[model samples]
Target: MPDTAASKRFTVPIGPQHPALKEPGHFEFTVDGEIVTNAYVRLGYAHRGIEKAAESRNWVQNLYLLERVCGICSHIHGFAYSLAVERLANIEAPPRAQAIRVIVAELERIHSHLLWMGVSAHEAGFDTLFMYSWRDRETIMDVLEGLTGNRVNYSANVLGGVKFDVTPTQADIIRKGLTFLEERTKHYLDVIMHDTMFLQRTRGIGVMTRSQAEVMGALGPTARASNVQRDLRVEAPYAAYKDFPVQMVLDTRGDLEARFEVRINELFESYRLINQILDNLPEGELNVRVPRRIPAGEMIVRLEAPRGEVFYFIKSNGTDKLERLKVRTPTICNMTSVVRLSVGHQLADVPMILAGIDPCFSCNDRTVQIRQADGGAQPNGLSSLMSWEELRQYAIRKYEAR
Candidate 1:
């Protein structure tokens, strides 16, 4: 038996350099023997000041800047930002462009979710699952590269419409790729859900109750894991989401396993959505002309990114340069639950628990700083110091502004 009387609580740092996380984020755990009693996270290691930089850049230049926020979700970021600017400018993209946008967004979701699945599998010590998921992700990357020129950052989206157009042959290639992904993802889902070892490692671990998730403001699969039926795709339809209906997924268990299931299921949902968009793609001009001067106004636009609800607020003073640009990434909203979920879990499982949320450290790193409990101001990593209350107020103000 371990000698409890002689042992004192010790602090262990999980990252900023750990192998488990795909990107860098610092997690510190206070452990009494093997069980974690508390946890703390340090973010902003990757802050690029993209939002503040948007203020100086012209509306068109900001599209490229926003796309670089996270490589995996580049398309969604560009799509959402362009939609916001379009709303302010009172311009509508062609139906074909809208459908194409949806197709690309769904494809991006497949790539990102697959990447996360591989990373999460690695964190849980299942190298085989990691390899299989990552290997299959390449197929989707090839499809994206075929549609656009690049694999990772497609750079396909422009303000009025997409930069690239899919030829009939390219569309056929995409359809074939989607078929392959649908088949491969089925096997992946079976492995994730039915594998005894995976279930043992993830199920009932890092459990969060519905109340806890809501209070912590969890979003995406993290929120869905707790039976929260919130999805920006369904709630606030944008782009082709307005045309294609989105079915929100929810599970009541609120555990690491539930989140795993939700994401795995979403892969199939993405396939379905992509197929739908491709089949019903309309024939029209790909882009509409956007005027140089946007009317003086502010608008808040939200999109359902692979991670969760991504909100972009843009203000224009009838100039090329934006008055203010702000983005609330999904990782920022989900970071609050980290401390809550880490408590009472084994130190060995910390990495898996953290990865289960599919946290995006790079996106989180670009946060605004605020005052700490101490008199001096301190920077919070991966999230703004602004509370959810403050964010709602900011969103309302932007919507209300002329």
Candidate 2:
């Protein structure tokens, strides 16, 4: 029964355009006086039919296409996609290639997490922390550029193995960069944690209890903030992760500050992993030649992206063009918890609350459609699929017609 004593609430909408979020998304809040009673999120503003697009491209071409899914997670997508193809084609990359993949993955993690920390700080009106974190991020980017040809979308992965190889000289530069980032991150943490103003703004804001986090299926640092030890690298190791062990990080507070802390700590962990991979560099052929005719098979590969666990499923019909490619991004899992976290917070807290997930809207905005018997065309734009209720109705109709 509804509680009669509870006060009535007013609705407030936050962004498809706001200073807080870098991506386009919308949120609605039910407010009672100054406190939010409940919140709802609407996404899909940047969907571009990437999976469908992949089907049109051949396996080799899709490697570059998948890397563009999210700039920050470019390497992980390529890694997972290439791993799937490698499994299908029965090809094994050389040990040196595997180690180089590890180094690239960790460098991408450092860049991504540092970028998030800066954006989160900016959301909370802490400009100094934001500037410092972004400045530190360039070190990792430079290191990546020194190894891979490109800085943002490092098209390093090929069908059977990696395209870019790290030499001894490049390895030394990477090591120096990691050392610099490690020291800079320590100073960054001091500013974010000890600074009274930063803590006062972020602490206890956008709290999501452990149970709530689990029910909502939060992933990555967002779930880690709730004390859930669910790192895919540690739980279901793949690629170089199978060789190198990783310690999962967790905290029980489940607040904005907690999420911030986990990501900051992850940066240090990434630095350590990079150094370990570089010190024990393996020597072998970087790539193996794969046969033209791949066996007809389906495979699923999961990797730990900077944000959380990313899943990729690929099916091939013994042809260059894939039969199907499916991806489950971390942002999709964490969006559910975003609504819960936004409740009971002020309007000003909305941006910080959303930023707590360190969301990737482009990854979350994906939509795939098959033909329907409703005598209408499927919608293609991001905003059209933003409504969850509408998506549910579309799914029900699609199933019922079948």
Candidate 3:
């Protein structure tokens, strides 16, 4: 329930329970008539303590846990973690393993983007687009299951390499699926670009200038829509991306329509890349043996997830368990853009604006670290950590004062 005590202007609060938001997040939009004058957002309701949980699990065990970080892009989560661990162990996945990883990653990208498009369309009240897109998405889902024996997690990536391989039969199935999806995706692109009804909801809506995107730290398609070339695949190639490079899809309009264009065009790119990997898969062992005890050191893995850059920081203490692990997901970085962009838009447009970023609330809900303004080191060079009890009390005081 919203507080009864109020200010001069009306404030509309949406979620931690709302029809528009599928996940838990709270937003207060201060509107004057139909125009939003200010906006505020609060996340973290879906925090799963995955990072803290990773500290207790062994290196191989954490692979499963971390992949659950975001179901939509689960393969990328495991891919990033395995890459970071391989660096720490001073080993690399075999060339064929790397190529297989890329194929699976691209397949996941197809799944994620299609899922996001359906959700975004639903947010816009376009049930037709939502339904059709989701129906086509099952094609990719089926291909993934046929290849890896799972629809969502896939669990394809292990420590040194992947656990699965692409057989000739699986390759034929994937090619057929891609052929169907490519045609459907092309139709989606045409619809978003020329549909009169859809344009009213997306074109020029939530327009963020190029400078604004750069200043606000937009990532993935959000930044790329603003013509910010921030794809890690092209900038810092990894895995099979080093062998089979991708052309970063970009758009300069910096609006909802541009985002749709950039992502749909990216689907075509993913399709091309997947076919390339399957045709030129290298021959080698899937995985290699690694010692149970990893050397004491720290490493960071940055990968271009379906959603921009997914960052991972790992600290191994020469044991099976990790000492410290931190993940800064793309949604957190893009959340700032959502709030600032919502201001001055219509009240009804907020949902579309929020969905434009394809947020994964749970994935972004990591532990928060409070630092000094100067970003200087604390005493003993270790930053202070906020406890749950202290944070609860702080929230109480803040609300009571408000």
Best by lDDT: 3
What count of clashes does model 2 give? 0
Candidate 1: Cα lDDT at 361: 77
Q: For residue 340, what is the lDDT in candidate 1? A: 74
Error of 3 at 380 (Å): 38
All models, RMSD in angstroms = 10.1, 9.0, 10.1
Runs in model 1 deviating more than 4 A are 1-7, 367-402
Ranking by lDDT: 3, 1, 2
Per-residue C-alpha lDDT of model 1 across residues 1-402, encoded as one tens digit per residue: 576843666898877875356577787888888999988888777887887878877988888888899888888889988898898988988889988888898899989999999999888889998898899899989999888988987888888998877788988888898898889888887887899988999999989888998889989999998998879888877778888897888899999889988998888888888878877888989998887778899899888888888888888999888999888999988887877788888888888878888888777765344422344344544333666577778779889995
Task: Output the better candidate (1/3) by TM-score.
Answer: 3
* Residue pairs in collision within model 3: none
Error of 1 at 144 (Å): 0.5
Clash pairs for candidate 2: none
Per-residue error (Å), model 3, residue 234: 0.2
Where does model 3 exceed 4 Å of error? 1-7, 18-21, 366-402
TM-score of each: 0.88, 0.87, 0.89
**Model 1's TM-score against the true structure:** 0.88
